[model samples]
Target: MSVRLGRIGYLNVLPIYHPLETGILPMDCEVTSGPPAELNKLMDADKLDVSSCSSVEYARHADKYYLIPDIAIGSRGPVQSVLLLSRRPVEELDGRTILVSAQTHTSAALLRVLQAKLWNIKTVFTTGSATDVLGTGERPQAILCIGDEALNLRYHPDYPHRIDLGEAWRELTGLPFIFGVWIASRESWRQNREKVEEAARLLLAGKNWGTDNIGDVCVMASEESCLNYDEMCSYFDGLVYDLGPEEQEGMRAFYKSLVETGIIDEAPELVFLP
Candidate 1:
């Protein structure tokens, strides 16, 4: 079988994948695009060879995949995309219900960690459609939204308690927040390591080219969203796409928090593609 690659079906990934889309890194392989959760499921089921996979999903099944070296979808601060839109301040939401988007695992887990470690309060999280939940005359103290939806809802005046999960994470741990990563499934890697390495090389080239010309990327990306050129530029500015030593440290901190919260029996070590 040819190498099967997966990409997040969100504009946030354009910085890297845009180059691929523009034929900058031409590779003769099939690339599937979908939401992060769906891609994670595909990776878990051995259906995807490589993917821009969810950070949480890798932790959930680390033995199945190898992290692509020096690549990530993360932010140092104010990631404008993963947000907690709240009716009340975060600290004040103790014992209150928060509606979570059905599309994410990383941000949801991050919220749990923040509540337990940063805010020093507990809040109940329920996963559902916001409109459907509210239609039942239920009022949640907050709602978690990720990707384009979060960007669109971030500025609503009614949500005075808006918190960018990335920014909050920086305040809590003083490190970058990794949302997703490029990974090669070990199943496929064991069968065809050469193909996996080729895919990784092309992806890294795309990442380098795209980040160097964010202006061009912003223009292309702006045309796809409600955001204007400047807004799109700023949004891209808030995102970091590299996984250096510091980024790895940030991941470790996040895993440590997960350990403290008993989300996992222990934090799995991040095994990268060699």
Candidate 2:
């Protein structure tokens, strides 16, 4: 049976997937690329054997998936791509409608956590494309945009109050924020342990190679995305790929915050492959 891999179609994930996409880590597997929300659904449905999915998704479905050790898309501060664009201050958003991006899951949840725990402001939330909300002249009072779309909005002068979620999380919890991780269904790993192991090795290797060759990766990423070479380098520079002990502590803090706010029933234990 062929192993299916899900690739997050965002520049933030370039470092982790560059080698795999550029044929450096050759493996015989089927790959699908889409936004985090799409990949999250695919992985939950067991459509992809192993994929980078929202970090919160792993906590939500802990029993169904196991994390591939030492690989993730995270940030110590100011992720640049995950932004909350508002007409007014975050404190003034109470009872106001905020348009959320359709391309994310973790960022959306993080927005809720911030609203409830940090800002103490409750607002009406709706989902739509950022272009429709910001470009169509029917802009909401507050909007949440993630991935390349958020980066594009940085040039727009109308959004004066831009809140970086990663930065906000760091200020609140004093730890790195893990956005996504490599996850595989328990059943798929049980049936194809070797394939999964090979895939994990290639992934970690790809991450290592990308980290060493970031200048090259940034050039290619700049051509494909809206960011320039320097901007891409700056963006990638802020991202953290290694799921080390400090990152784990950050995730645990995030999970605990989610639970404290009643966003999730409990903080699920993170299980990793041997």
Q: Where does candidate 2 stray beyond 4 Å?
A: none
Clashing pairs for predicted structure model 2, backbone only: none
Compared with the true structure, what per-residue lDDT tens digits does model 2 show for residues 1-274? 7689999998887877778776887877899999999999999888999999998899899999999999999899999999999888889889999899888889988998988888999988899998875566876787899988889896677778999999999988889999999988899999999999889898999899999999999998889788889989999999999999999999999999899888899999989986
Global local distance difference test of model 2: 0.89
Which lDDT values do the candidates have, in the order given?
A: 0.88, 0.89
Model 1 scores worst on lDDT over the 10 consecutive residues at 130-139
Q: List the residue pairs that clash in candidate 1.
A: none
Per-model TM against the reference: 0.95, 0.97
